[model samples]
Target: MRTIGADSPQGIPSSLNTVDIFMSHEGLLLEYEQSLTRHLPSPTDPKGERKWYNTGAHFLWIGDRTRQPDGAHVEYMRGIENPIGVKVGPTTKPEDLPELLNRIDPKKEIGKITLITRYGAGNVEKYLPAHIEAVKESGHVVVWVCDPMHGNAKVAPSGVRTRHFADIITELSKTLRIHKDNGRKLNGVHFELTGDRVTECIGGSMELSDEDLSTNYQTYCDPRLNYEQSLDVAFLIAKYYANEREDMERNVFRL
Candidate 1:
């Protein structure tokens, strides 16, 4: 529930209000500003346990770098009951997933685990199918969420690492298609976005270019979609899902 707008230190415009806009969509925006804390053992506790899951956050995830099966981060997350996710990058091996899934979701409970795919645009088509097949074959029910932004990142002419809007859409489309082909469903999308008018990402309906980025590129990490750009993405994703639902209904009617 952070305040949005140019009045805030983040330099986003009040009119954008991306947080409020998304909140209306029945989704929870779990905060991860201090995500590193999830890795460290509690300072005051003797057992050195991770305490972030107890703080009432709706969802928590371990980043790609910390998802190693033997790592403490995953070990800590394994015991938590909150819906959890792990970032899966291109280099992830299909053979390693059973161990990871076993560690995190030993019971294979529905909605308890999510696999967030971050394979880059070029590699997703090549690498994602194996992971999907592996997961399917294991009979583990996991929500598949696409992290298109991270995988599609490229260095813009301004030297900032940015993701192309078209590339983001392409990856999302491909992920949906892959999941459908595998007889699984793609449940969500993860994005790095702000409720500001900053010009960090290129393309979208605004036709933002490299030159526009110099105006207010304020992100410390990856480039995020600004308010308008974020809305554009949301609408596009909604359309994709709507079409999917429609197709499903049509197939049922035919049967």
Candidate 2:
């Protein structure tokens, strides 16, 4: 858990190498987003008029509950130039993917769309494969990312909302493996985390149990990973990719 110092060169903290950070949010508050929306001259059109962009954030995603094909959210998202994400949960129907893409990404624009899957650990094995196949069949270009936090949420006996680290890891690992086996790359991951030591979620390297949730619980909404827990997850993901690279190298050697 290294902290980036403000005095570091190029506006990057000393703890981290230079990196690009893009802002994102769930485009739920349409009014606020609409107010921030602005039109800028299109790069492809020197003579054409400006194009609409929700300058509020570089990227915005539609929640699973609001991605209706003819819904207002989809309509708003379709008209924006920013890349959009659609949350695909366990309830998502494989056959409906084409219709969803038809509404949001009619142009089949590369990198214009991302599908964030949030099937729980138990449901991921069953639902993700079919969803992957459906997207492949539709021939729609999309980046696939895993959102392990939302699906693995649970309420403790003490009536506190918490997510188990084990469940989160399980869901992420299964999602990645599923994508690899299906010949599609799992492009990225989304997580709710904080640098502060808040005991919002349980079960991390600290072995924080339900009893410890009362110590520093702070969130009014969804629980988030404390700094140590966030680092734990980052290390695990690094290990997964390292093993994957090792396997790829061995295969190439064999070839």
Candidate 3:
């Protein structure tokens, strides 16, 4: 998977290897790993370079079923939260995740992994902790997606109305506080964005109305925000943390 950050590109001495792997620790489908030999942190040691040199000869995000000089999984990229026939929906067992994580450990079996999950499940508020505890887990780092902009706009359950992003943001803040109060480092946020300017949190144009918010942005993963919208959320996250009186703030707002 490609990481969105500073050291990624524009010359930071990062390995930045984009190659495919047969296994991934979490939702990272091995077949989707077309290239993992690009954009990696500068290897701390020579062995790190060996890890780079030892990458798959031809990493393919899509296996034999697809072919292309350059290809992308558009469907997977669009959003695959709760599939129709699949039993793995937002409410799927959290234990299922850890098991999958083990099955997909293609990297260094590194603990303290960071993940992006649906804010709709609000697992950060509940299930995530249970999952973390069940593994007797001390090697995971979870940053939740609490952007209302990403929430389904049309079908936001019974009472969560349009323009509910602020509320969701507050909820996320509380979740962070809860984690920290309990001595867990709930380090950051996982929000969506792009390069264009987004006018509204939900809508047809760059802007959105309450009606628009009611449908599209209401889903678990809302319309992909333009670059402008994306950065707005990033700034909003920063503001959220700035207001807190906490002692430790290690939040990194990854796009």
TM-scores of the candidates are 0.77, 0.91, 0.47
lDDT of 1 by residue, 1-255 (tens): 254424544665555455532121111222332342344466667998765543435567777777889877677677655678888998789999989998988899987888999987778889889999888888799989998988888888768888888888888888888888888888888888999898889999999998888889898888999899899988988897799789989999999
Rank by lDDT, descending?
2, 1, 3
Which residue pairs in candidate 2 collide? none
Best by lDDT: 2
Write out the backbone clash pairs for model 1.
5-12, 6-12
- For model 2, the superposed segments whose C-alpha errors exceed 4 Å read 1-21, 44-48
Cα lDDT of model 2 by residue, 1-255, tens digit: 235434555655554455777899999988998999999887788697799999989999999999888899999999999999999998899998899998888999988999999988899999999999999999897999999999999999899999999999999999989999999999999999999999989999999999999999999999999999999999999999999999999999999
Candidate 2 local lDDT, residue 209:
97
Comparing candidate 1 with candidate 3, which one achieves the higher lDDT?
Answer: 1
Residue-pair clashes per candidate: 2, 0, 40
Off by over 4 Å in 1: 1-53, 252-255
Native-referenced Cα lDDT, model 3: 0.40
Question: Could you tell me the lDDT of residue 93 within candidate 1?
Answer: 93
